[model samples]
Target chain A: MATYPRDLQYTREHEWARIEDDVIRVGITAYAVEQLGDVTLVDMPAPGEDVQAHERFGDIESVKTVSELFAPVSGEVVDVNTDLESSPELVNEGPYEDGWLVTIRPSDQAELDGLMDAAKYEEYLGTLDG
Target chain B: MSEALRETSLTDEHRALGARLVPFAGWRMPVQYEGIKKEHEAVRTRAGLFDVSHMGEILVEGPQAVAAVDRLVTNDVSKLTTGKALYTACCNEQGHILDDLIVYRLEDEKVLVVCNASNRDKIVGHFAQNLSLGTPWNDVSDAWALLALQGPHALATMKDLGAPPSLLELPYFSVTRASLGGVDLWAARTGYTGEDGFEFFCASEDAVALWRALIEAGTCHGLQPVGLGARDTLRLEARLMLYGNDITEETHPLEAGLGWVVKLDAGDFIGRDALRAIKGAGLGRKLVGFEMTGRGIARHGYPIVANGEPVGEVTSGSPGPTVGRNIGLGYVPLALAKVGTTLGIEIRGKVVDAMVVRTPFYKR
Candidate 1:
């Protein structure tokens, strides 16, 4: 079974958000990585770019297909992970930690509350298989 | 409405091995087991087994089988001896490719035509429409299960599994009959991956037993059960043209870098006239290999650009694990198909720099 950390909030699109003070750390869930097989390349948004909740900021391509990375909450991009440039497999190895895609200072902190909690996300993932 | 997906005889075995199954070309098949990269590497260095039963096979047998097959395929099938196979393509009247396939001359009166799974029905119908009356033809695709054992160490693994040591003496594209675990198998010294290996065809009922036997015997050689994902990458690294992705009904055989298989002087075939005309007029667009000098992998259907304008489309592109470079195949105008030609691939909207290079991206 893929790990779903209890502390992180999740999106229906399979993105995870760790809510910090004014910024939210974002990455794709482990389930997404497993589904994508081998992660070949990642195209991440640059810092200072404006992103909206539920909008596509970038994409991650696997050998079989391309999946767009959706923003769980709207914010200004504070930092983008440059480590993924040379080592995109980090996303497949550590989707929750070193694989984190971006940090965004939330334009509206209330958006995090609308995201699903770990338990709800796991239940959502279960429903998908059925 | 779409047709219901079909399952191979080894579907249960694939599930038991923890394969991630997906729908492909009207069949439920394994996309990967552990990972595409690991499986791909295993085939490059060690040995990897693939359940390629989804590939279709048709048997043609008659006094005039050779004549009918010669009229259908581009290659000179008349040159094939018993137990020899020839890689060729079946084309339309327009000289466009219908499907690329391998023809095995099992005997003087018997021939086996292996085709892509998606084009099986179309090819069967194509033969029916063209073959002479009373010619014996049978679509025995479901009667056998296909397995490809590939890698540098593949031959060693086969010998360990009771295969005769003399099997190694068989030339490439030759077939020999063998028995393992009391099951008769047709072992062909051929493979899609650019490696010394063999493809085995056995009765469908004996699939699980043969798969288990091979797995148990291959443990010492690091033989892993591979999936379609790795199969695609491995073939791409070798620059093997895929039927749907690389060659299509609209793509002529010569333009797809398959001119070697077309023997115009051999004899008359279905598309000979059109192909002869094309040979005289020269090609307008040619398929060429390219490498990404910029970041990101150029995917299928991505537009190829020259001097800031769209000139062609990428047919196959991926991160070649064996070649250790992001390589791709695309059709470019004859003027831009030359080696060292600078081209750009529009990835996600931005054009990325790429350069045309010599093909067969991975050399063993």
Candidate 2:
């Protein structure tokens, strides 16, 4: 069973977003990490870059494959996790906490409503298993 | 799908340890236990056991076996002493590699040919049509089980299992008969992880007992069970060539950076003249390793470009757990195969900067 938080919104691609005021904390879901295996590299987006919702912001490289990291919502990247360049394994160690990828100030706050909630995300993951 | 794919003798053991099972080479093999990186690290630092029964094993014996096998393979089989293993590529008349295999000389008249599981039928058919004129060829793939106990602590684990006295004297690429827990076994001092280890060949019925015994014996030595996923990544990190991925029926051994295994002047064999012609004509492209300096990985079939011109395509690539970077192998033009050559890999329409690096992206 994967950990699913009720407080966060998720994209179909398995990225999670926690909205705080106008900024959203972005990271990959626990299920995503489990699917990707051990993460070796996380290419972070540059701060101040504008990223579109559901578009590729960066990539997460694992032992066997490389997966594109998508933005959960349309936003301007305000902060990028610089710590991941040297310790990419942190994503696998603490996916929901210390492994947060970026902080984004959404271009439109209404985008959060369009994303899936905790229950829906879990259901989505179940569908993926089949 | 085929009972979730056939389980190995250690399948239950892997699940007991919380392993992630995945399909590999037509078997339900464990892809990881704790994780690929951790399991790989355990093998490098201590020891790791691998269930490799999916590898095909064919037994060739009889009086005409020597000459028959020699003419079928690229390497000189006559020079092999009993209990010695030689790695070589079996090629067709066109000099293209059919499959890479390990030929174990068990006796003057008996030989064991280990080939990739996916190519088992093809290889056996090749032998039947080409070399089994009067020799007895037995496809023992279903009757035998193969296990690889690899890494630095492999010797200690073998000692704990009451390995034969001949084991201590076994050098690299050597095989010896040994008794473990009263079961007769063939132990070969060879592995794919670029570490010191042994491969055990035994009856399928005794596989579970031997695996359990080895695990029990290796517990104190930090030996862990590894899977096919890590097996591939580890071998790639060591610059070891995989048959289907790195070299195929359309690829020559020399083009795949395996020229050392091709002994041209030895004797008459299949593809000898073609290989000699390629040697004299000079290779157009050669396989080389590359490290990604930009975002994304260089995956298989990804185009390699140098100075805006396409040079080759990546044959293998992954984020190396041990090396902490995206590394890959590809066939590039001869001029661009040199170390430190700058190139680019096209991934999803984006060209990522890469540099040709020396082989074995990870070093112990």
Candidate 3:
């Protein structure tokens, strides 16, 4: 079983948020990587694009399938992970750390509170398996 | 609740190897073990073992066995002497493909037919419904466990398994009776991957023993247990057609780049007249391989775009692990199917640039 980081917030869509000052970095969780298998490429939202919460920001492609990446918070994308453009397998290797998809300058940081914490997300994942 | 999926004799062995079991055709089979790309790399670099027991096997016997099979497929089966196998396509009366298969001539009056799992029932039913004679044919799928040992080091792995010189020296698309670990079996020098490999047909009861022995003996040769995931990619890179995906009942054999197998002059066969007429009329669209020059991967069902309109459809597409590029096969107007022809694929409603390229993207 994969362990989620306690310091981050998660969404039901399997995205994680890490808030650092005004910037909230976002990426799909380790669970998503495991489900999709090998990560081939990530189509990320460009900087300065306005993203609405619970809506699609970009998409991710695996070897067999492609999936939509949803936004956990309404925000303006401040930066994208260019490293993923060349080495997308890093997402499968470290979804919580170096594989972060995009960093957003949030319009409202309070949205993070509504997302699930480590324990709550683990419970949510259990429901899915059962 | 869904209907229960059937399992092969080696299901337990696959589970023990930590394979992710998924429903394929009517069977629960492994899709992957560790990762698809790694398993694919293993087969390209060394050797990989595949439990292809889900593939349907039929044994046709008696005096008319050879004649019946030759008339059933689009290839010249009569030329196949004992121990020879050839890939062919079975078509319906309308000239549409029923299934792509490998027919092996095991004896003067005995032939073995292997087909796709999804098309097994349909193909078998076609035989029963069409063959007017009371020929002796039996579905011996349950009687055998099929394993495809594929890659560059496949010969070494067979040698490592105590196979005799004749089995080790079997030529391409040929079969021979062989034994390893005291188990008698038939080994065929044929595979879906574009590599030097062999497919072993062993008794169902000896499946576990044979699989275990091969794994144990293949350790030094770097043989990994491959699953359906890598199997599809490896075959796709080699431009091997997947039954339902690449060649379907809606597609014609010639239009799908299977003209070589359509032997019109050989003999009168099912769909031969229709195929001949279709060929004479000339093909409007042709299946061609393409690589993504833009940003998106052209996946199955994606529309091929030209001048803001859909011109064709993608049948099979994926990242070619060996070719290191996003490649796919699709049908387009023959004029637009030439190499270096620029095309666009609509992925998620966005047009992405792509270019037609030669097939078998990864060659040994």
Ranking by lDDT: 3, 1, 2
lDDT per residue, candidate 3, B134-166, as tens digits?
Answer: 899998888999998999988888787788899
Give the lowest summed-lDDT range of ten residues in model 2 chain B: B1-10
**Per-residue error (Å), model 1, residue B62:** 2.2
Q: Which lDDT tens digits does candidate 1 get at residues B164-217?
A: 766767789998788865678888988999888888889899888889888887
Off by over 4 Å in 1: none
**Per-residue lDDT of model 2, residues B1-364, tens digit only:** 3555776676787888788888876788888887888888889889999999888998999987777788888888888888899999999999999999999988778899999987988999998888846788899988898999998888898889887678866999988778775667888888899888999999988898898898899989999999877898889999988888899998999999889989899978999999999999999999999999986678889999988888899999987767877889999989988899999999877899999998788766
Assess the local accuracy of residue A46 in candidate 3 as a C-alpha lDDT between 0 and 100: 83
Indicate the worst ten consecutive residues by lDDT in candidate 1 chain B. B161-170
Q: State candidate 2's TM-score.
A: 0.94
Once fitted onto the true fold, the runs of candidate 2 whose alpha carbons sit more than 4 angstroms away are B1-4, B293-296, B323-325, B361-364
Provide a comma-separated list of chain B TM-scores, one per candidate: 0.98, 0.96, 0.98
Query: lDDT at B83 for candidate 2?
Result: 84
In candidate 3, which residue ranges exceed 4 Å CA deviation? none
**Separate DockQ for every predicted complex:** 0.84, 0.71, 0.83
In the range A73-107, model 2's lDDT, one tens digit per residue, is 88799998888888888898888888899999999
